[model samples]
Target: MLDRDIAAFYGVETKRLNEKVKRNARRFPNDFMFQLTEQEWSLISSQFVMTSRMKRPKKSLPYAFTELGALMLSSVLRSPVADETSIKITRAFVAMRQMLTFSTLPEKVVTLAQELYKLKEEVNEILADQNDINESTRAQLDAISTALAELQASRSQDATLKNRRPIGFIQPKEDEE
Candidate 1:
């Protein structure tokens, strides 16, 4: 199935759907999904005519995730459609895997495992980068909070000085008839 079709079933715009996957980040390991490099994109696009007529807003192409990636997505996003879609998609994947296992040459399993391992490494790197970014943001926020506290203290002192009133303003005065 095309990525676009699966994205639509989740009730999210394509970009938002991708972004959600990106945010969860860890749930998707490499076997589940990987970015399509230019060469890979060219190969995929040449082989498949599905996206040929569709007008894309950007020049850059999007990555395609395998069935495993789609299953990983359901773990992160909690929507009614996600549940149903996950079940259906997982079944399809299981059938495909079973077919591959039964029909494929025995020698291919080693190569497939090696590729899967590399993909998992890439997914781990993506999650690590996200964690680094979160850490940096937390540090920046802490610095900003410190600066704000200092500013607030200075402002409070100035306010006390400005707010002081002379005796005339506070003393009891007779109201003229």
Candidate 2:
């Protein structure tokens, strides 16, 4: 992102944003942020008509910040907007990482679902062939199969809930009740 764009987002002047970056020079390494070359800036500026703020610029080249640098700006900037956005951006990053980490889950779930289907089919066939199994017995088997499926689903979901606080109904005190 360009310094002017990021400044606009953080609700600050482009110069002010760059001032913080300058003061906290150690925080913004080469990978985090860098100044755009004159040629690059001209090309970019030509590609897109300059915004109102961008038009008024008559100083050093604009700084280009990577996503990490954008986050780091929140820490350097001491504004309510920056602080709030920083928290939201941090949470968004965490959520994105979680999604990426769980990208392989569909395959596992499909495998479990297929196994459950095969098990249910086998149980159904066996119950069908057994003449002694009545309606009640068949119903019980169906209920058991459903419960097994629920268990498998819960087991898979447990991994995600492992780090979260448990949620459940809390029994009231006898006197309170």
Candidate 3:
């Protein structure tokens, strides 16, 4: 990336970015960044429409940055925009690296899916066992209820017999006029 483009992406002015680079000169080595020749600058600048406000002298060539240079530039720039953008760019690169590193994602997913399936099957078996226990408990409770009902009927019959008079007793009491 060019310094101007990088600065624009980082929400800083081109001049400010260059100023920070100049201040931290050792931070950017030759491989990390280079200046475009006048002829190269001319070709590049011609590609973009330059208004009167955007006009610059031929001597003022833009600095070209490699990926490392751009990252270093972000670090050198201590402003909030640069800091936040640097963190984002760093995270993006890290994510890319992680994506590349985790090439076995499918295998991991398959393993996890198998484990989950086993867990689901185990849960179903436990539920089935609990249902069997519940059914047996319900049957026992029903049997106890029926037995209690029969005992209650027999007690009620005995009570009724005790309350009735003897079948052969017919006379009224002598004391009763």
TM-score of candidate 3 relative to the true fold: 0.46
**Candidate 3: stretches off by over 4 Å:** 49-53, 87-177
- The worst-scoring run of ten residues by lDDT in candidate 2 lies at 50-59
Clashing residue pairs in candidate 2 are none
Worst 10 residues of 1 by lDDT: 168-177
Q: Candidate 1, overall lDDT? A: 0.77
Q: Could you tell me every candidate's TM-score relative to the true structure?
A: 0.50, 0.47, 0.46
Instruction: Quantify all predictions' global Cα lDDT against the true fold.
Output: 0.77, 0.83, 0.82
Kindly list the per-residue Cα lDDT of model 3 for residues 45-115, writing each as its tens digit.
77877722254455678899876787897779867887787777667767777987798888899999999
Per-candidate clash tally: 0, 0, 0
Candidate 2: list runs displaced more than 4 Å: 51-56, 87-177
TM-score of 2: 0.47
**lDDT score of residue 78 within candidate 2:** 72
**Residue by residue across 85-160, what tens digits does model 1's lDDT show?**
8998889879999988877665688789899999999999999999999999999999999999999999999999
User: Which one is best on lDDT?
Assistant: 2
C-alpha lDDT of residue 177 in model 3: 68
Best by TM-score: 1
* Steric clash count of candidate 3: 0
Ranking by TM-score: 1, 2, 3
